[model samples]
Target: MKPYKNKINRIRSFALALIFIGFVVMYFGIFFKQYPLVMVIFMVLGLLCIIASTVVYFWIGMLSTKAVQVVCPNCGKATKMLGRVDMCGHCREPLTLDPELEGKEFDESYNRKKPAQSGE
Candidate 1:
């Protein structure tokens, strides 16, 4: 089975990674101190990454407001879920808001809009 994580947690992880990457990029810039232009370029790129991460963090706050808060049946813990299918943040148990999807295998594709069926 594919590894599944809570939507919010996944996005948060991405943001954290971006911050780490930004620091790493900036650290690399120190190595190019001999060349002022190259060092400046690296610093700018690093700053952009940090800025992007801040934007993503803000976006997460917006998404959190839209996420549904529910008690996980498997873990018995309150968790926020986004989209049609999400996993429990604590236990990684698959969750769904749609009755039709219950008992079916967990698939992230279910969150995507389906193409219209053509009449054969």
Candidate 2:
């Protein structure tokens, strides 16, 4: 079975990675300092990455505020849930808001809208 992480955490992780990547790219720009044009290009690209990271961070912050907060039964810690099916942020326990999905095998697909089944 594939391991699942809370959506909010995953997005935050991605944003953190972007910040690191931006710094690394900026460092690489130093190597081309002898060529002013090349160095400028690298610096600009790196700056753009950092700017994008800032946007992502801002977006995630806004998104987090809107996510539903629930106290995890498994860990007894308060965590945020994004969709109908999400893992507990503290314990990786599967959580669901829908009664029908409760006690059933955890599936991320449950959060997605299903297409109508057509009968021939």
Candidate 3:
């Protein structure tokens, strides 16, 4: 089976990982204290990672407002879905907005087609 993840949950995990990465980079800067230039670079890179993560978190907040809240049929728990398809955050069950795609295997490719290019 293809590996897929709930979009929101995946994004949240990415943000969390970014914060950890930022801290790790900053920690590594300590070892370059003798070369102030290298230390500054590491510190700046770490700060940028942290800032980028903050932006991603804010983006998620905005996306949440537009996401569809549905009760997953598989897990019977509420979860948010983005675009035309998403997986259940709790059970990883595939969910779709388009009736035609119903029962189809969950593929991220379904979300990438441009409507105009497809002549839709």
For lDDT, the strongest prediction is: 1
TM-score of each: 0.93, 0.90, 0.90
lDDT of 1 at 11: 97
Best-first order by TM-score: 1, 3, 2
- The positional error of residue 107 in candidate 3, measured at the CA in angstroms, is 1.3
Estimate, for each residue in 1-120, the C-alpha lDDT of model 3 and write its tens digit: 877899998998999999999999999999998999999999999999999999999999999999999999998999999988889999999999899889886777678775324344
TM-score of 2: 0.90
Candidate 2 residues lying further than 4 Å off, grouped into runs, are 115-120
List clash counts for every candidate, in order: 0, 0, 0
Ranking by lDDT: 1, 3, 2
Model 2, 1-120: lDDT tens per residue?
999999989988888888888888888889998898888888888888889888988998999999999999998999999888999998999998889888998888777788335483
Clashes of 2: 0
RMSD of each: 2.9, 3.1, 3.2
